[model samples]
Target: MQSFRDEIENPIVQKEIIDLEKKIYSFRNGQIDDERFRSLRLARGIYGQRQEGVQMIRIKLPYGKVSSEQLKRITEVSDKYSTGRLHITTRQDIQIHYVSLDRTPELWADLAKDDITLREACGNTVRNITGSELAGVDVDEPFDITPYAHGLFQYLLRNPICQEMGRKFKISFSSSEKDSALSYLHDLGFIPKIVNGEKGFKIMLGGGLGSQPSHAELLSEFVPVNQIIPTAEGVIRVFDRHGERAKRLKARLKFLIKDLGRDEFLRLVDEEKKALPFHSYEIETAAFEGPITEPLLAVPSVTIDDVEAFEAWKKSNVIAQKQAGYVAIGIKVSLGDFYTDKARVLADLIKNYGANELRFSLRQNIVIRNIKEENLAFFYQELAKLDFVTLGYNTIGDVTACPGTDTCNLGIASSTGIATELERVLATEYPQYADNTGISIKISGCMNACGQHNMSEIGFQGMSINSGKLVAPALQVLLGGGILGDGKGRFSDKVIKIPSRRGPDALRYILNDFEANANGQSFLNYYDAKGEKYFYDFLLPLSDVTNLTEEDFVDWGNADNYVKAVGVGECAGVVIDLVATLLFEAKDKLTFSHEALQEGKWSDSIYLTYAGFVNGAKALLLAEGQKTNTHAGIIDLFDTVFVETNKIELSSSFKDLVYQINKKEPSEAFAKAYIQEGVAFFENIENYRAKDLANA
Candidate 1:
């Protein structure tokens, strides 16, 4: 542990790891509150698991890019800190489970030695920034978006504005108009666009998936590359100032846009331009512009033992790169689970044979880029040694799943179990679909959509069915959802609920009908043509609970009877609304505002002051037993409960005082004055609390 501490070079990162260690010690000693400690650990990517004493650590990899050295480092860290198993998430992050809570600081320091991080990977902060796996090598892309994605990830990693918000924020970049990165389902999504030969992006905003899925609204058709980061600053400022705070489920940016029309949301975004740190922050793409590697002197000639298998692998897993004479290979990682042994082997294979870089796909697979076209056979043979060469890479056989009951606290069923069973059914019986890239099947243990199940062509959500004096594991069948490209898509329709044991049978029925009657149309088009009710009727028999046998009481991959037990989810850190805690937080934010002001970060200072106002107001509102849900609601309610009533007098309304953040430019004078206002507001609240307590 001391060796790891000595390896850290960045003073800020070193301080972060030290603070985490101290916090863990305080929490173990009962010096820190449980809810407060949960927030701290989650923001650092240390999450409590379903099991009592273990944690799940999510390793954030920007745009899913990993170097051979970094991959080897991750394997080493995983082997030392936790189990050797690595789980790839739908967001292109790698999660390792069953870790001791106390060793996280050392684990984080070890990761930092290779320039990998765990910050903001979980909790109610900006999660990992993702991009197209083929970003730098896609033939259809107007330009590489890798540098832009990387820049955003760097700029916001430990930024002051998003350290703690109401809920998690997600951002993505699609390499092309295909929207392979699923742009339509993120808080902010970017698709490359070229206007008059100038590179830009088409922005999508406020889209999300949970129990309720909403499509994103088109924010901008085209924004110049230099202006994108500043635009993002404005958008985040607005979200931070007005997003929800108390109601966890309703706290996402989508609900705010739904409450206020898109026009008003964009108007607010425009209003924050004056508060942005940079009017146009340009990203340097020179380093990512050219080819990363060249072919070796000679192509190795080899005889293939099974030419048919080789051809199938090529058709399904191999992709031609934009760089001629090079190709990218896809390795289908089943259920997003891989061991460190295979990881090390793949790391060596990529370093020795292919390009030294790899990108993890949103579907939980790995894409090795920059392999010479002539070396495809050689690379395939090398990957085969590690059992890493899996065909049907992103096809129907390649199912996407989350760590359902295996690790996640909110898991309701066995997503990994069902996903494995479905893949087996597809490979053994429906072999013809081995190359069918049109359909996608995804599963989530619950409706959280961690697996992006609600947006797949065919989807399943974990649920339970109630029978007389008994409960059985069930899946909510969904249909007709898929990406439509260019920031447009549809959510799946919940067709019916069926027993989990009949999951394979349900798939068979759907595929059998589609193959017989689809008439060569894609699954989405056929689903649209046939309608939800038609399929619902066809699969209605599976929904019958009266015919359930003893096996139906057990879930997939489980030997015991099914029990519906869901733990508290830490995906969004627990909300602590204690009046004292809120007041302390307000004062802490005021301190941060002063520090940012000294650093000449006027935008950061302004946002910090705004957060202070919100926290101070929410503290008083909670003292008065007022419901503090949204930031906007807090401001308005404070004006009603205190300002209007003369309990706390001010020159203007509370809304007017707080909303000045958008009206005034982020200058030194404005930041200093705003800090004064926040200080005055907090003092007034403190005095009122003291008087109220004394009078009582």
Candidate 2:
């Protein structure tokens, strides 16, 4: 049980927390690294978030699987140390946010006894290694890849060569044809296969999500079992050597893959592989560890009641297990947000009853693996306590919005609030359209597009305008973007720029249109029968006003971005977060010197400019979260950066900043140079750093 001191109200702790922040920042700035210093930083709750004072503590639940006891611990830690919510990320890892600056180390210690880890979850280090939850147990009859995934994890965890890369790299493992794990969306996607009777892997190189997204290119036809490490090493080497270190925004693997054609990228890998000494492995079964035997289980007795509902959930959400009498249950969580109490109770129930194996899903949900038929009823009842068992109906309100204003500092329009309100409204008003399956609507507060609104069946992104003298907030809508379980993946189109308020109605209008013209058929079948143009015309109609048109066009998802100086934060869209830290060392100087407020083209409207400043600052903080700039310094504080970023009073700043700079324009080299000069200015100081014109 947790002690009373763990609570925020505990005396003799708040000051300690304050002191801890100093130590953490000191250590981060390289002032200290002693064990005591490190321990103090950890103890103070100074975790390495994507930024300073922002803590992102990633808990390792082996193989994307968490035990109930472990889960309960997570709940406790979150409730005590954080905002009391846990985010089940795209990777099978659980991330907690709004974590206090000092309670971080204590949070780490709380889970220390249970074999969980928070090390390397953030920073310029290898993040949590993820794999298919059912690596060995899928009855689909493919090779088990648990050992391979685990082996890679062990080797890469703090391995001198991989601890730091050109950028963060994610590796995903899949055992079957099903892309359930969305392995192709990762930097290194490993698929298990046998070649000439020996187990091996088919490696796909250089895929990622972010400002620039790329589908991995198949590199190795058959990487021998022993050579997986070296091949991966080659991929890393190529990335580190050729990665865009100068331009932070364009520095991801997707751009690398784009720069290097598929064949050339593989050729570089092959060349790197040729020089490395290979270590072969003794062949064993290549999948995962066998299912946990009941003898090892601490499961309590469960009583069944609701058979029909359970069966229905099992039909669409649950999948077959390799182990008999066991099934994998998928809990359809909305965007993977879990509160602390909810986490703790669910963890308790899961640990005591489930197989001590909890799987996080890609669509932001939790799954209990190896659940017995006998326990379904009891588990259902328990889940209901934590709000785990809600039926999902796909509608305008069934929107998947990222943590817009809740935690992230870069958000413009509060994606979570909008999504919740929209989902609630849509669920209540349009039952027919809301209940439609095979449909998804996603929202991202800003153009950095963490929400991946670009891939939504219906998508919304935050945008703003100088509506007369007042700044007007709105959402731009994109239609038809989606992935397919049926192998017909198509990207959504930027059909209309819908306002934030009209977002739900616009979506409902489209779905209802789909409902009317669907001609009484299945989802995909209807889309197939009615081609893109037919559906486009039906949804958009003749005019946009009485016909329902949204606000402005403000999205360019994963298709190469422009020279983005500052992005919108998940919390608020700000442009000058670093100005205080950068412009004035002593914040007290603000009273004497009005330089920042006066000479800096910063608008006189304190309310509006301050809001933009907050948004821009948060966006910069989030950009810091990407591990691109870790020196606690600011870059791109110039007129070009601020004007494009909306830090200054530019009318079309958002659009102009997001406008794609043609790769081949005026020689791609010169265009890249201008961007590079702007990016490199803040850090290098003498050569390229430009004064902040907006707050000069």
Candidate 3:
């Protein structure tokens, strides 16, 4: 209470009010609109999100570590104004919704109290720094990267030079070879190691995923870890000085990295490192805890009988401690959906009943460290109230899924739903898969691919396909995805695709096959050795039904007369749903019927081709039209839809193109195609022509 009052006291509030009043005086003739203001802000690296009237603010949670004080502030601010739900994103960020724009200042003030804030949380800026989630706990790691992650976060947050760059940049730290952080796939990846008997990091440059995906290359080896800040500053300086400032879509670090060869890039980085502020002790090894805390609970003193399954739970669910007898218990939360009220209750319990330390895991789960055996039952009871404590912490559909169409306009499909469905199917057809601990599966809704599907033992990406007039749903299967336990790392391979509706069957078949073939190796290792040929050869036969008489309808995927076939993932939903609706009768909303036509404005023919777009640019056409509507709505929607459609050409191959909402710029060719497609599809609808290139 004393601390709260000391912090919120007065002159600060009045100073802020005066400052804001002064800033408000510079408004455009005292008549600025939200859109214009938003655009101006965006151009300068600010963002505005759509939630309720209350703004939904996104703040980067890089590498997923925050100070205890920061966490308390988050809770306090959230409770004061919000519904109190903090979403931990797949990119390792925290987002809060239902905040009023007017209250933004107040919210910011509260955040400032804890040295936390919303800087570069949106727009085309480098997001929060991310590090391996297990950085401080995984014993297999060479060293904990928490200090470095925080250090970099401090250095990068609103840095003057980094405030403006060619595009958003990403950085990751990996002390372990596991690469669970997926460092190779980021803009900057740091791998811990010892070179010349000196401990430091092997830094990689120019890695990212966007329209074009590229892995980073090694730039410097054994750069003392302490030199990270200066080395980073130099690299950013170079990027700031040299990265593309002309093309918006082509401005990513990957483009820069691609433009320069590995050797030259390294030379540049080395040259830049010369002027950096490097310290000798920064790269030295730092200590961290083990991956799993041993069960902190001691032997029971009373005659309390527990189920046999409890023993398995104790073994598989609880990780052992580096220290004798102390265990870390993982309590998985489905969808990471827990109430703020519940968090308070749990925090109170930890303070009074359990250990003081509570750790949040990347799997959208939470852990309580060092609980005495005698208090296990009591701790379990408190967690049960929040509906988070479960014996099956890592089982079934406790699947990792990035936010999709639900919140991110960038999504092509609904990943959360798909994850739920997959879990249901697996549980329905094969319960053992849920209980199977060896295989790790992940899913993503967009090419942003936050689920880290590329490295899962088995992974799925949401997609769509055109089946006549109906848009059929499907998933692309990625196999051979694996991360090193410690730095020998290789991501999995893409094996096949299957209909989304049939995802469960495909997963079961794949898992069962592994079960039978395993000569005692883990699922991931066995699948790696099983090779691509085995999977393709097995799944290929099911793609197109050869003969009606031979096709097994009982086990095969078929809704009515159409058989489901595999297709590309990511933006696949948009085009395929378009195709499916155009060809078949409607069973679901994806049909190309009146309901679909009514969904948006671009469903008309005037949108097709660049010629049509150029011709339709009659600014004041609403001057005399019988459409019975103003041009305002039409113009806004047209720009929104067209921009998304045109932006996916580069990475759509890897993305599910079911719907288009590209964050980058579209090409002339792409814009031409979009307009043409829009015009043609809408104009000659009764005599639809999607089978040929003329329509596609």
lDDT of each: 0.90, 0.54, 0.54
Indicate whether candidate 1 or candidate 2 has the larger lDDT: 1
Residue 525 lDDT, candidate 3, scale 0-100: 75
Candidate 1 Cα deviation (angstroms), residue 612:
2.3
When summed lDDT is taken over every stretch of 10 residues in candidate 1, the lowest stretch is 290-299
Model 1 C-alpha lDDT versus the unseen true structure? 0.90
lDDT tens digits, residue span 1-696, model 2: 964235444222443434445666776776654333433333222333334466656665445867777777787777777677788765666778767655665666566545566655543345567777666668863677777777777666534334333356677777665644555566877777677797777776666655445566667667777778777766765664455543556656777778777777767666554323333444344344554645244545665577687665555556678877777766667767878777767666666666666777555667777777666666677776666666662233446667654455465665775677667766687765533556777778777666767666677777653434334445766666555421124445555554455666666676677778878875545656766666556445322433322232222221221121223221110112232243222221222123323433121111122222222332443433432231112123323354454444433333333122211222233333333332232233222224333434
lDDT by residue for model 1 (1-696), tens: 456778899877898899899999989998778898899999999999999999999999999999889999999989998889999999999999999999999999999988999999999899999999999899999989999999888889888778888899999999999999888999999999999999999999999999999999999999999988888877777787678877889989999889888999889888877767788898987877765765333446777798898988898899999988888999999998999999998887777766689999999999999988778888878788888788889899999999998888999988998999999999999988888888999999998999888998899999888988799989999999999999999999999999999999999999999999999898999998999999999999999998999999999989999998899999888788788778888898999899889989887898888889988898889988999877778999999999999999998999999988877877899999999998998888889989988998
Candidate 3 residue lDDT tens string, 308-362 = 6455556546665433455567776655555667677666666555445565666
Per-model TM-score, in order, reads 0.96, 0.68, 0.67
Clashes of 2: 37
lDDT of 1 at 484: 95
Better of 2 and 3 by TM-score: 2
Q: Model 3: how far is 685 from its true place, Å?
A: 53
Query: Which candidate would rank higher by TM-score, 1 or 2?
Result: 1
Clash tally, candidates in order: 0, 37, 64
Model 2 worst lDDT window (10 residues)? 568-577
Model 3: lDDT of residue 64: 63
